[model samples]
Target: MSTPKTTVHYVEDKINSWQTRSPFIILFLASLVGVATGLIGSLFQIGIAHIISWRMGIADSEFSNIYIKCLVIFLITAAMGAFSYYLVKKYAPESGGSGIPEVEGALLDLRPVRWKRVLPVKFFGGLTALGSGMVLGREGPTVQMGSSLGKMLADTTKIKNKESQHTLIATGAGAGITTAFNAPLGGILFVIEEMRGEFSYTKSSIKAVFVGCISACIVYQLIIGSSPILNIGTYISVPLNSIWIYIFLGIFVGVIGALSNFLILSTRKFLDLFYQKKEYFFVLTGALLAGFFGLLTIFLPDITGGGFLIIPNVIDELYSFYPLLILFSLRLIATVICFGSGAPGGIFSPTIALGAILGVLFGICARTIFPEYDIHLGTCAILGMAGLFAASIRAPLTGIVIVIEMTSSYILILPLILTCVTATFIAQTLGSTSLYSEILNNTLDKLGIQRK
Candidate 1:
């Protein structure tokens, strides 16, 4: 028989051994979350693409009566929108809107994850909403669904540790962004910069984020060929003397971004006043909006969808100054209508498209004024992309890195930094709230939960 002291010593050693190995175990689980997120996100992307193709193919098929074709397309899109809105109303309301706010709330332990409901609802609802050619991006659904997966894994495995849960969720979120844009650095920076308030920057957590991002990127590349999301061709470096031009562009974007945020918030509030009493009306309104956009898509495809198809064309100077301005104005209206109506989509891509349009307009005017500087409109478009994102999101590093990764134009780093920094400063000086923060507060207010 062993002495009492020996027994005590043996138990202590066992406890120490398990403690030492627990971090590795958590990390392994996080990696699994990353892999799962990547697979699901890629599938989501493929599903959206397939649906869009099918819709377009049907529309383009030879039809004896053009009116029949329009009616069929409108009804189909309206039905899709109705089903998507129904999912949000019936299943998981948290899955509605750009899910970044929900994820942020979850990080702070202020909101319930409801992963079982959210995962399915977001996946299918996003497919329907995006498939109907709404002005939305997949990043929102992917990030929300990814984070839900992490929470599901944790709950299923019965992990009670708070830090581990937070780490895993953050990992999944970062991986989601990585797979969405195929930009690993942007994913990592999003976690570090965008979720700074809720994320705990522990050594273990940081390592877990890195592993998750890398794994997610690898899976994404394997499925969706490795190419920059935006294949805009390279451009000559901006002349040193032209740096001032970017500063001006940044200032202009900063004002527009602030105004955009105000309008989005106001529109949401205005719409809510009309629909808060009858939830079904909100859903039907969304359907009507979707149908209207369907009509618009047939007439003017440029202003609908996630705005990706129109971006490259805009950068190539396909539109003159007045046309660019008109396109921007129409898109601004579409973005506010789609996003303000609480459609399960993201504003990120729409903002990017608007910024690109504004930049091209500015560039066209600049080139006309300063004929000697050899101004490249494409360069201005790229800068505007990052500048507006930086100002609106208030995550300049993430915005800059994402634009660089998506465009594969690291040579514009100086201008990107200058533009993003100036935009951020001006936006802050103007007292504009960060987009996600405003959304989170709105959500919390609705829940009757005071911020901790």
Candidate 2:
């Protein structure tokens, strides 16, 4: 009996030793990935800004006329789009979607992590597509590239443990969002909310994600100077009576969000049918779209890029409701076509913008119908943001966190909660799943890609 007791105690000691060692090692390795993700993310942002400024400088110089500037922009964007299309079509076709979905899939061993191909392709390809003034956001590409970088480090260091590999992947992703918006809490929330299906949320993983987010934010602040992406001014708190209005706004956004997703899926299917495995068709289509958008950049700059610059203007009433509506509709269509065409762009920012527009319209209507409430249109704008995004993506928590982080208006959390929850419920009741997951599944179906 004494010998048996001694053996059991020895086994217990070994288990405890392993448990203690694992956390320490994971934390240390996760920190390394965090620093790399932060540095790479910061550099990527700076690089894109520099590219855009340089092109604009050349356009402003005596060497380039109006026609010459147009020509240069067209060629640059066309070539960029063509190259980006080639990479997505040939190397990692699964990378065509928002990349968030791919990360989710990867966690479940449902997708491969081609770090070597994806990291470079998404980095430079995203730079080209974004810098060319395509209506794309850098956030999606950054997340994909950040995750790839994590995979690269794991492979290079001969990380044999599956848990270790997955931990780094999530860590990098958190860092990516952190760097993208200079919002650490948002980064953590994104992983927890959007990637819930894939992320293995453990005590250590949560802590690691937090660490990565903070580190990435520090790097981004150092480079970008710590400012909110949008300066919509301070917002008045939403009264309890006015909260129901946000719910109604959420329902309206839900309808629109459902329609937006339907269109995107339909457009994707049409492109698949038309292209019919012809890579050139894909590349040429991208080039043509890029050229057209580049032209818009020169003529009507409001209709281009991720639409961040347009939000504050709209909120400030810089554009009349009618014009804003028209612009909103046009951008909606452009966003669908551009994203559906798989042009290395993201619909995230555009979706938020669309929601803002809808909210503004709703607010104006509410004010006219019931002027005694002293309603603020900007609050509706914020609510609409969470609502549309929640309705479209079916991730209300993520939408809420993202909007709050982007605008730095955490005071409206209650309204945001009401809007996002209402929108998500309505959208689901009306039959729409998460947007990114749907797109990822569609892409996988087209490619005949599968995971056991």
The segments of candidate 2 whose C-alpha lies over 4 angstroms from its true place after superposition are 1-22, 58-69, 447-452
Give the worst 10-residue stretch by lDDT in candidate 2.
Answer: 55-64
Tens-digit lDDT track for model 2 on 1-452? Answer: 56988999999888779868667666766777777888888888888888777766755667436788788878877887788788888887756756887887788777888988888778777777777777777778778877887788889889988777888898888888877777788788888988888788889888888877787788778777788877899897888876777778888898889889999999988998888867489878878887788778778888888888788887877877789889988989888988888766567778888888888888888998989898887888888887898899888887888889888889999989988888888888889888888877875676688743
How far in Å is the alpha carbon of 118 misplaced in model 1? Answer: 0.3
Off by over 4 Å in 1: 1-22
| lDDT computed for candidate 1 | 0.89
Q: In model 1, how large is the Cα lDDT of residue 426? A: 91
> Which residue pairs in candidate 2 collide?
none
Model 1 scores worst on lDDT over the 10 consecutive residues at 18-27
Residue 322 C-alpha lDDT in model 1: 86
TM-score of every candidate: 0.95, 0.92
